[model samples]
Target chain A: MALSIAGAGRNALTEKAAWFSESLARGLKVARAFDRDQPKMRISEVAAKTGMTRASARRYLLTLKSLGYVGSENEWFYPLPRILELGYAFVSSARLEEFVEPILQRLSEATDAAAHFAVFDNNETLCLGSVFSQKLFGFFISIGARQPAYAGSMGKVLLAGLSDTKLEEYLASVRRVAHTKETVTSAAILRREITEVREQGYALNRGEMTPGIVGVAVPVRNKDGTVASVVNANWISTSSIKAAEIKRCLGPLREAAKQIEMRLASGAVPTGWVSRER
Target chain B: MALSIAGAGRNALTEKAAWFSESLARGLKVARAFDRDQPKMRISEVAAKTGMTRASARRYLLTLKSLGYVGSENEWFYPLPRILELGYAFVSSARLEEFVEPILQRLSEATDAAAHFAVFDNNETLCLGSVFSQKLFGFFISIGARQPAYAGSMGKVLLAGLSDTKLEEYLASVRRVAHTKETVTSAAILRREITEVREQGYALNRGEMTPGIVGVAVPVRNKDGTVASVVNANWISTSSIKAAEIKRCLGPLREAAKQIEMRLASGAVPTGWVSRER
Candidate 1:
């Protein structure tokens, strides 16, 4: 079958060369045209946004529609819920949520603050799961949102887990643009902060990612003791819940992380990580 | 760009033809391969399940990965949280959740029963949004899951909204396989039930889909008075909440559905409908 041929050929060095060909690149950009701010677009709008011809935009949009990732009505185009299957499949199969959701829910109930689980994706940290607290004015971390690895509590926790050489390389790739006055913009400052996070077994960010958002995070370790992920609790700065208050919740947080680690160690895969070659 | 080929040199007929081509068919299967039961799969698993070669799966996976829908590490694949962007983009842009979520949340809070918002996807009803009740042991409904349009409360509500001819066509397509003893199997019986639902402006499913699970649902109309969707509240028989108790919550549900209609009328586009023409 063409599928086997494609699969066997993927590992070949020559296949990598063909993989990045213009057609695939164009196809990707077409898919990227859909985002939170602009979920629906007309054919002309798609063409303008994607910098492709109207004819081309229509083709890609129709192709995507046929693929069930894109949907349309009249002349306006929009994405579909089935598109989530792609991502949900990755996360659910790994049992990441099964391992972590209960923990986060329990932590939220205990700490009365929003709890989040995040993992590193390239140079940024992406929220994988979150359980919002009952408080009216608390952390509102949207799942799938990204934050730089040097400023937010979740980011720092994930950064602290990275190998030193990889960390250095990442730091060099992107400028430490300050998100707020409290954000550490210097590489030296962030490096030191990450090192301290590794030493203290936790990370704290006070209004760095967003004003009034303060969070404390602890690393979730694998059986090998490598930091596999980070879990955090977020609260508002006005709640009198300073870093110390966040620290107070660390016991339960650590316990939850340990529980998740045990589950993952028991052969439950982490969410979003699918074993392909095996 | 090659994207232009999707729509170029094609009239409406050819465009429709392109919608069902082998490439698009394979892509749809790949997308469908991710579901609640199997959220993530290895390349070989995807290949096996979708009848594609591992190479074909890799290409599609890599293509999706580059588009930020899929993420990979060490040859292990997983879905990214950003993939929710697709589902959210569809739901949010359609403005269905803006009105529906608050209402569902309120209903769940009021009755302490699980509430869900669903819409017709061809012959099936797909969950667009959901809110679990504060009470324990309520029915569980996950976003993006699909159910037969002839069985569940939400499904009946949507079916009641369909044009008579379309409804008849759909009824004829199913084998009326009983999921539970209470499930309606005869076309004559189902047609009668649907007529009653249309007349009463609501639908009820008493242990039709899952034994001991009872649900009540109402149709949500769009600005044009077309049945745009349905909202349902479900409870277990053990809860002692009879179908009447569920029906009492319809006032709030209808109010929320109206709000959703208003939002959609104000310019929210439905996100899941595929265009007949490319």
Candidate 2:
């Protein structure tokens, strides 16, 4: 059956494009609007966040609930674990374990630190995969965890990968939170840090986001030489011992990133799974 | 801005519902249709698998591409990393780490085995969280990994949690593949095994799914007294040493399950994150 959205009044991108489904786009927005800060939200909360009418948000939430992707109790609505099927669909389809998992595991083992591989998502860096070394503090890396662009080594490396225009746009749009006393919330300072990350081909953070954890990250590049993902190894250290730890982890982190880059360049990863845009 | 589907035919459940967005439902189906086996699919393939016409599939895929959730290479369409946001939204909203992560970590450390917490999803058991002990085998449990209901201790415990009628229907419908010679593929045998699991309050498997691994699992129950999730600990063992390992792990698995059950019952976890259905 043919579907039409003649006057749905969506964004110009979908409005101008033929065969676009505004309903689908809006539904996904509603699904994503419920995050850690607002796990269970009302229709009005969703509408306010997603810029959809309350009626539109209600329809999408109810539809998702019926599909088992969402659940509701009284006026509160929240996502179900079944919603993970969507992410797993990508993780499984990408078969990231075959390439990224082993590398992270090996890196973690070698450096005695937690290792992670992450990609840029929205304005944050999202961990697509991670391996917890457990040798340091009980710092368990949660998959799908996010860190702001100005806070972590991996985040700065990811921000460095963006084009100047995009990076500027991101810095202008993002609200920089002071996660720790060391967090750089100034856009000008973050821009300088990202610039240094680009030149050095690595980024280092000394408890900027989370205290006592020092991280060293290097970018994994695609065949086109653009950053596809960032691989990092982090350790728990005192201020006095931080420099030696960073120095110790940097070589292995860079080596692992190069291995991952070579794998991507060798055409082992699916084309669709690689970072195609900033 | 009222939209009506007066003539568009869908399943009776959705057809009878008010304020249900069919476009949204169909769009999610198209997204989930790309899994490990069919990472990248042609329009015709997606159409046939999702039971939509080629034109409809094309529209959904294109719309998803525009939204950065799906990517296309020539005639093939595949999901993007952005799709993980949908799953992460649920994961972040659920905040499962507060109860499940530390418990799994402790269980793994105590048993010296890899530990995982999984829930029933469709016909398979989906691992929602896990911890690697790095002691027994280098067997890393990937989150979002799925196992057949008849194959693993965790899967069997989940299957046993089903009502008799639902269990019967599931056994009838599932394609039971023999992952190993020891795997029970016979429906009658599986039914008997599930019955024993229901009686025993736990399940054990000796190399059924992976020939070298022995696993024991116990169900974590919801406030309603139904199984919410299954906690498992597994070790690499030969057939000769399997029974001892299973016995060793069973106690900790049960204890961990109890802790998780208490956490769930105490309303410590968000209500929307709990298993409201089998």
Candidate 3:
């Protein structure tokens, strides 16, 4: 499996604690087994995917259904809208949406592109908040959207924030896909690009994830100088003027990052656990 | 105490099954304990809030921390952004945001007010999607935002959809707080308003939730004629002309609801479990 359990490398005492509930972990894993690709699954498929017994999977699904997180019809089970509360619990508590959204709105409107703030999660770019350009007929990336860490600009910027050993482990484990002809699938090239992003303080993507889309991203650093999150903007790529467009967005994206950094430092946004320091 | 388990009234066999994981439920309940009001909590507070023994609460918290769903500093624990994946699993699987956001955008643009689509979630209005008014200075309601069912226009519209027994149970259990001077605290008054909403096929609120906001909502029905969701719009209340302003928005809000219903029936938006059938 390309996706490993998050935080599996935590210190030994925590993992071996008698208080740890394996059932809770397994249940959560079952709930997460559904995504864009497999929105609905039978108990057997879930068991196979999560490497759990069918009986165990059935119990988890039924429990989720009882909790209103999963809905079942016959043998197929899918997640329900009520499941959003789990994510909402975090977003609302952190109050990140209130603090970061207006900045994204302004950034999107000014750049004439979709603006997003994302964080690194299990070797993927997890979009925490997003704002669409006022211009009609644009792409959509909803909050909680995830993308491969090796391809898109936001993903690369987040990857650049990781420690060297963590970065190497990610590159070694991730199953890379060539989403477009321009996507860099080689680990060596990805390492080099990430190094450049680290030096330049920004990452740029031109038709890497999607054709004809220019993505620019910069890290939003914490007070302690660790990358807390990444702020990004996406433009519809024009073959003749891609560089100019990317250049135009960098100023706003960096400024937005600084604004977010200022907010994070102000103590109003409680991102207590978002610091990725190992 | 007002927030009961979402589907606690289900049939017997599912509850008695040996496969059900009580630890998972308790852990999820612990995670949910941290909200806007209590963003960070100590072990004793968690135990007190969730009605669990401190030892049990400690186990769940440690388990969650290990899974990366939670972070702790000293004795206080808060949810991490990674916790969002639990909710994103459902949102991405349903693809509701992609389908409904454009509709909300158009509604917000036309009405010059914040537009939202919501459903009844445990006696609260759960905003599934939202779009803010482009007029630059307006309210913000993020997706997963919840409001009391007895207060807001959307809440009334959703309450009107519930069965007689369900409605009675909800009224009996909910602890209503008057958010503003105009807020209705009397159960009899709320019942009258909800009955009127059912008859009129729409709901209107003037400074009920917030002092300066006027909210209008209409139900979106499924093919089976069950209320699947509610679409609503909010305008800044002009005291003397509130009635006329709400009247103007009714046409657009009802139209938006119809559009959502049409799209839902077209099979493009799969709302498998949203039918709210008893």
What TM-score results for chain B when candidate 1 is compared with the true chain B?
A: 0.78
Clash number for every model? 10, 0, 0
Residue-by-residue lDDT tens digits, candidate 1, A196-240: 998999988788878778878899887667777788888887543
lDDT for model 2 comes to 0.82
lDDT of 2 by residue, B236-266 (tens): 8775345667677777888898898887878
Cα error, residue B229 of model 2, in Å, equals: 1.1
DockQ per candidate: 0.28, 0.64, 0.68
- DockQ-based ranking, best first? 3, 2, 1
Kindly indicate the candidate among 2 and 3 with the higher DockQ: 3
Off by over 4 Å in 2: A1-17, A238-241, A272-278, B1-17, B136-138, B272-278
Per-model TM values vs. the true structure: 0.79, 0.90, 0.91
Give lDDT tens digits, candidate 3, residues A165-231: 9889888899999998889999999999999999999998877888877678999988878888999
Candidate 1 per-residue C-alpha lDDT over B72-152 given as tens digits, one digit per residue, 9 for 90 to 100:
667556665555544444544545434455667666666656778887774777776666443534356555666787888
